[model samples]
Target: MKQFIVELINDRFMIAAVLLFGLGFMNLLLQKNLIKKIIGFNVMDSSIFLFLASQGYINGRIAPIITNGVFDAEVYINPIPSGLVLTGIVVSVSVTAFFLALTVRLYGIYKTVDFDEIMLLINKEAE
Candidate 1:
């Protein structure tokens, strides 16, 4: 248990990412407001990006930039995680924008951003 605790402490970034993800998940689950849910989604996305970035880094390795005519693979960190994080960021931004636009339209129609309220309003209108 002590060794596990020490290892967990050493991997600070991973621990932070997990905690952030938990917070975001809780926010997403508990929030009634659409905007807050969106914020939580963004937080979750950020945590994932952080995890990927941390995974891409090594303690002693340099970035994947080849220099000095050294072509050894061991000298540089893996570039895939960085690329994945970048792509995820772009996709998340687009998704977030789309969700915000939808929220705006929903608010315009329902007069409230609370998802439960919107559902109630819809049921009332249907009845």
Candidate 2:
């Protein structure tokens, strides 16, 4: 039990990622405001990035960059996860910006950012 607790403490990033993802998903699903939903999505994106970056981290290993005549895999951490997370961050930012733009346009049209209110207005317009 002590060892398990220690292991869990050592894997704090994974635990944090899971908690962040769950919180974000809950907020996204339960919130009625478009802006809040977008914020939740951004939170989830950050948690995913954290998880990915942590997966590539090694306690004592150097980066994958090779120098000093050292080429052993044990000495270098995997670079793919970090690279992918960097790309994901760029994409996440672009996507969040796009979503915010759409939210602004929706607010302009409906005069509100609440999802239910927007739906009601759209329905009333359709009728």
Candidate 3:
């Protein structure tokens, strides 16, 4: 137990990110409210971004930007993954906006934002 816990402590940031993403998605699926589910989706998106950013950090490394003009020249950090994560963060922001719009439309159509109610109403309409 001690060894396992010790190992987990070293990688806890990643572990936490994974758990946050999973739990957020699970909540989105298990919840019955449209707004609540979208909030969960946003949480899941953030967890992924956090994971990516945290993974790029090294114990002792200088900034990747050479143009910054301040470095010991002995150590450098990788910039590729961090750039990708920046792009991902932008995408997450766009998706969140889109999801919010969808939620608004959902509210307009059903007059109630609850997923269960929406599903029941859609089912009734289809039949």
What is the lDDT of every predicted structure here?
A: 0.95, 0.94, 0.85
Model 1 misplaced stretches (Cα beyond 4 Å): none
Q: TM-scores for all candidates?
A: 0.92, 0.91, 0.85
lDDT of 1 at 120: 96
| Candidates, ranked, TM-score | 1, 2, 3
Residues 1-127 of candidate 2: C-alpha lDDT, one tens digit per residue: 9999999999999999999999999989999999999999999999999999899999999988887989889999989998999899999999999999999999999899999999999999999
RMSD of candidate 3 to the truth, in angstroms, is: 2.3
Q: Could you tally the backbone clashes for each prediction?
A: 0, 0, 1
TM match of model 1 to true structure: 0.92
Total clashes, candidate 2?
A: 0
Better of 2 and 3 by lDDT: 2
Q: How far is 124's C-alpha from truth in model 1 (Å)?
A: 0.4
69 Cα displacement, candidate 3 (Å): 5.0
What residue runs in model 2 are displaced by over 4 Å at the alpha carbon? none
